[model samples]
Target chain A: MLDLLRLLSFGPDGWGDEIAQGALLTIELALATLPVGIAIGLMIALAKDSSSAILRGLGNLYTTIFRGLPELLTLFIVYYGGQMLLTELAEHFVEGAHVEVNQFVAGVVALGLVLGAFSSEVLLAAIRAVPKGQKEAAAALGLSGWRTFRLVTFPQLWRVALPGLSNNWMVLLKDTSLVSVIAISDLMRQTAIAVGVTKQPFFFYLVACLIYLVFSGASSVVFGKLEDRAARGFKRVGGH
Target chain B: MELLHAIGDGFLSVVGHLGLNTELMERYGPRFLDGVWVTLKLVGISVFLGALLALPLAVARVEGGKFLSRLAFGYSYFFRGTPLLAQTFLVYYGAGQFREQLTDIGLWWFFRDAFNCAVFTFTLNTAAYQSEILRGGIQSLPAGQVEAAFSLGLSRFLAYRKVVLPQAIAIGLRPLGNELILMIKSSAIASVITVYDLMGVTRLAFSRSYDMEVYLWAAVLYLLMVEVVRRVWDVLERRLNRHLLISR
Candidate 1:
């Protein structure tokens, strides 16, 4: 019913460019943060597995705090809290030195931290899914820890963990839109701005929804295919 | 010392303003409590409604009815795929665009109330998520159980309600609890549209105090609420699953 082309014009007045850029930023933010999340997740799983009581406590506390809080609210804390910390750091680290984490950097860190907390659980499960016998057998063979982990543990861990990690990635992607709150100009925020300028809340918001749907929809298919590829080894060799 | 002094002053201002606290208590304290009551009412109603709506959609996915199933699949795809904030804004502000036609048909009354709007949007959002979990849980059920139920002359409804639903509940509780946590957080979004829960109080406090600390206090309130809710839900889930003797 509404004129769709005029609604999405790439011109200065047309939000086409901003919305498109927002979509790109959302994807990039998610992709950039996945490694941080995965790495932190691995460390968390390790900590949870550690014999040290303090390590176990820290691991438990990390997941409990991050997972317990709301993502939207957490974004606010990071945007503000991270600024306070960096400013506090600047006073000590550099004489009259100033370093600022912009909204985008703060966003990536905040979202990734949250993602890391959730991803840790999935990683813990994945790591455990690797058989105990393999570790024991590797120890019996007198292989060094690094070789045993690299050769035996991680390969299977990746296979067991790929689906969950990808699922976390999709969530990370969608939640990046939340950072638009601190005015990172990501897709949803950009769409809201476009709606404000165009005086067409309905049209712009609907378009934003469609954009998210398309992105996540494509990701689901891709993730499913990846899972299938990961499982292909088992299929060919006969069932686990 | 200056920052510490500023913090001390902020604490003093908050504490010394007994009149402010008293005034807030006098004016909207009941209303705030009512808001909490309404939120509980909303979360309870929406979760149940969401679960109910999810069941048919989940069953359709598992059953694979041609046209209707495809329609359900599309519904889940569209709803689950979109962000909840986008949906909230669309329902509250975007739906206002069609008020004239909606009013002409007398549907305006339902849409006019912010609470109804919140419940409706929240129900749809949670329904989509819950349905996927339900579908997965149901699929996880042993096929032989269905056969055994049928072998005992149980009808589909009885078999599902007694056999399938119980197991699905146990399987689905964690995800469902996660959804409930999400619903609590998302309720704060409703404050943007004039349904004051907690953040609404933050706005009011900021206007009066003109301080960022008001928002800070609000954030602490939210953090505390989330922590309490998390512990409570963890206990409830553990209680529910005690029959299985599995440690979560």
Candidate 2:
């Protein structure tokens, strides 16, 4: 146990600082990906719910492809394929300039694409769950389409979308581990390094697991509070 | 005419580059097929084993006493809260740390093989998710249905066996299908531990060729597998819910 503590302790011999840094990277990666993902999800939800057939088909295809593929496979494709594409383009346009995709960018883009896919499905369902009459009522009040959506639909949509989106967020947090495979210095990658140095895979992995549990456990509480806040003006019929 | 020829040449060059990987495919084609087979076996066995384990645990969660319910809850909570990749690493590597003790108990052989470790980890992980889905399905049933079973002179166990389980299974079919799909996707993580599944083969092929086409081919295969699963599940869902379908 003393040996374990020393190995994890902060110093030249310890991986404590590296692991701490990795944890922060994981947080940063997830946060950076969230808004982009949510924005794409919102657009997709709108597209799927829109009256246009072409937009709906495109939205469905995007979700199906992303959600259906394994996240790791998606990451690999994004990282490697993006690099190849960029290199090709650079070679064609620039005489001798080289292009590269860093792991951070690759991780964010891949994860955000996937996040958008899953969250769009959730958001689409949430949008449908909002009563149709509410929109008509907004229009009856002489509210324009954009104003009605902003004032009425979007606010209610979040409440309806909260639980599913929260689940997606939890999943996104854990799925960030896949980025470690690409040599990203995320929590999982850092733990892998620690395991390599300390020859204590079990100890370091257990620590990683605990760190993840803390993140998820805290997120659950935070989401629960947000859910309660979203439901503040609503009444529960059976007190469920 | 010049612009048209340039456009044609550009398209042909792109195709030529992508198509030039025939040698890579020829060399790794059999290996890729073998990897797919291994992946299928891993998913099949783990999901089967997981469902078998989950049923009783789900029952315990929904109907058993405080101790059993809490035990079930704790298992699911821990497994669900952590990343599957971490759990895989813990099992694959962490188990190695206790080789002596495990060997003493004659369990080292299970942990020694990456395939076994993967199956074991995936089984436990899927079981946790499956148990929760089952518990939810059971809870979702109208209370009167179970009461109706009891009122028909069925004992509690018989009531569950005769009435509750069948109905819960029906309601649980879709979520259970979703679980299976998730398990299939997650089985790729086994590659990280050198299991040589599809992703593992892709990694090996890429190491040799450094061509991105290998990953593309692998992704296409994965997409194909997912599509089949989705289609099959849709058919199954319709068949299961046939009685519940409303007439237009």
Candidate 3:
């Protein structure tokens, strides 16, 4: 036990610092992807909800492709394919130019695209669940479409969407580990490095698992609190 | 034969128009086929074994005494709480740390193979998820159904086998299909451990040709597989629930 503690300690002989930094990066990657993902999700939801057939088809196509493909494949495409596309565009515009996609940014974009695809489904459902009469009432009160959505629909939409969004958040948090495959030095990769040096794969990998469990467990608690807060003004139905 | 040849050529032309580089397909086509076979075998075996393991555990969670229920809950909680990649790594690489003990116990051979490790890890992971789905299915049945079965003079085992399980499975069919889809997507991670699944072969092709199109092709193949499964699941669900369907 003492030996294990020393091995994971923060001093010179330990790999604690490296693992800690990796954990921080994992959280950072998930946090950075959250808003980008939600924004894309909102856009797709609106597009699907729109009257234009073309936009609706495009929205469905986007979600179907992204959600169907494996997250790792999406990451590879965004990392390698995005670089190729960007380089071609850059060279076309400038006489001589090169662009390299950052691993972190690639991670964010790929994960965001996937999360957006899924969350759009949730957001679309929530948007539809809002009473049509609410929008009509807002219009009767002289509210514009955007204003009605903002002042009347948005709050209720989030309350309904929160549970599904929270599930997506958990998935995103776990999916961030895939970025380690592209050498981002995320928590999984950091643990791999530690295992390599210490020749203690079991210990280090178990440590990584515990760290992930802690994050997920804490996330569940926090989301539970948020759900309660979201339900503050509502009456419980069916004794739930 | 001549008509078939013409159709093939037209297909090639369309693929070329889509910028898929038919020449690369010619070179790597057989290898990709092998990769698909391996991926299918890996996922098929794991999900099959996982469902087998999950049924009893799900029963334990839903109907077992307190100790068994808690034991099953802890297992599900740990597996579901962590990333599958971490679980795979822990099994694959961690086996090395136990080489001597495993060798002494005569189990080293099983742990030594990458494919075996991948299958083992995936089986455990999917079993956890499947148990939760099954547990939900079992619980969602009205309490009166089980009580009615008891009143009919059925034993506990008969009640479950003849009455409860069929309905629970029917209710859980959609989520079970979703879980299967999720498994297919996640089984790509087996490539990370050198299991040579579709993604693994794509990685190899990419390294050799430096072409990004192989990934696109792989993505298309994955999408097709997902679509086919979704459709099949839909048909199966309809067939199973035909009695519940309202006549027009």
Candidate 4:
């Protein structure tokens, strides 16, 4: 145990610093993913709810394809295929130019696409959960279409959406570990390296597991608070 | 004719410049199929075993005494809070550190193979999630149902077996399907420990040929599996809830 602590400590010989940095990288990756994913999710949700058949079809197809594929396979496709596509485009556009995608970017794009696919379903359900009468009333009051949605629909949609969105956030946090397979030095990968170096797979892996537990535990508390706040109005009125 | 020629050139360029190696695909295609089979086996066994394990666990969490409830909750919290990959590593590599003890207990045979270890880890992991889902389904039942069952002179076990389990199954159907799909996606991690599942084969093929199509093929296979599962679940849900639907 003493040796384990020394190994995980911050001195030159300790791997604690690397693991801590890896934890930070994991957070950065998830932070970059959250907005891009939510934006894509909103767009897909809107498209699915659109009047046009084509847009709905496109939205459905996007979610189906992304959600069906394994996250690791998606990561590989984005990392390797994205690299190839960029190289091909660069060659096509400029004689001597080349574009590159790093592991971090690949991880974010792949995982974000999956996140968007899953969350779009949640958002679509949330959007639909707003009572039809409410929208009709807004229209009856002569509010414009966008104004009706902005003033009447979006607020209610969020309360319905918060639980599912928080579930997605928890999943996305754990799924970030998949990027370690592509050699991004997230917490999982850092632990893998430590295991390889120290020949103590159990110890390092337990520590990594604990670190992940800390992250998920902390976020679950925050999400529970958010959910309570989201439900505040409904709770006061005896609504579920 | 012009379009045909351009297509041929594009194909040749993919073959030559991209180094797709048709010969290698022919060689490894069967191996990839074997990987798929192994993946399906892993998923099939784990989902079955996990469901069995989850029933008792869900019961413990929902109705067991405090100690049992906390034990179940702790199990789920520990498993759910961490990444499945870490759990996989802990089981796979961590088990090695205990080979002597396992051998003493005659369990080393189970841990000696990567496939068994992967299945064991996946079963434990999914049981946690499934237990939570089942617990939710059980809790969703109205308390009045239990009171009604008691008024009708049904014993607790009989009430649960006849009334609660069926309703809970119906309520949990969709989430359970979602869990199965998630497990299918997750079983790819088994490849990390050299189980050579579909993702493992894809990795191997990519390393050997440096071709991106291998990953695409694996993705397509996964998509097909997910689609079939979704369709089957839809049919099952309809059948289960047919009585609840109005004729209109």
Top DockQ prediction, candidate number: 3
Report clash pairs, candidate 4. none
- Per-residue CA lDDT of candidate 1, range A1-240, in tens? 547667798986577999999999888888888888888888998999889999989999998777766676577667766776787788897777656669988888888788889999999998889999999999999989999999878778888888888878877877887787678888988898887777677888889899999899889889888888777656554565
RMSD values for the candidates in order, in angstroms, are 6.0, 5.9, 2.2, 5.3
Worst 10 residues of 3 chain B by lDDT: B239-248
Q: What lDDT score goes with residue B94 in model 1? A: 75
lDDT of 4 at B37: 93
Worst 10 residues of 4 chain B by lDDT: B18-27
Task: Sort all candidates by DockQ, best to worst.
Answer: 3, 2, 4, 1
Model 3, C-alpha of B198: deviation from truth (Å): 0.5
Say which prediction, candidate 2 or candidate 4, comes out ahead on lDDT.
2
Comparison by DockQ, 2 against 4, better one: 2
Ten residues in sequence with the least summed lDDT for candidate 1 chain A: A231-240
Candidate 4's displacement at residue B72, Å, is: 0.1
Best by lDDT: 3
Model 1, range B2-24, lDDT digits (tens) per residue? 99768756755675574345444
Off by over 4 Å in 2: A144-146, B1-20, B246-248
Best by TM-score: 3
In model 1, the Cα lDDT at residue A61 comes to 90
Candidate 2: tens digits of C-alpha lDDT, residues B184-227: 88999999999999989999999888988888878888888888
Q: Rank the candidates by lDDT, best first.
A: 3, 2, 4, 1
TM-score of chain A of each: 0.89, 0.95, 0.95, 0.92
| Model with the higher DockQ, candidate 2 or 3 | 3
Fnat measured on candidate 2: 0.85
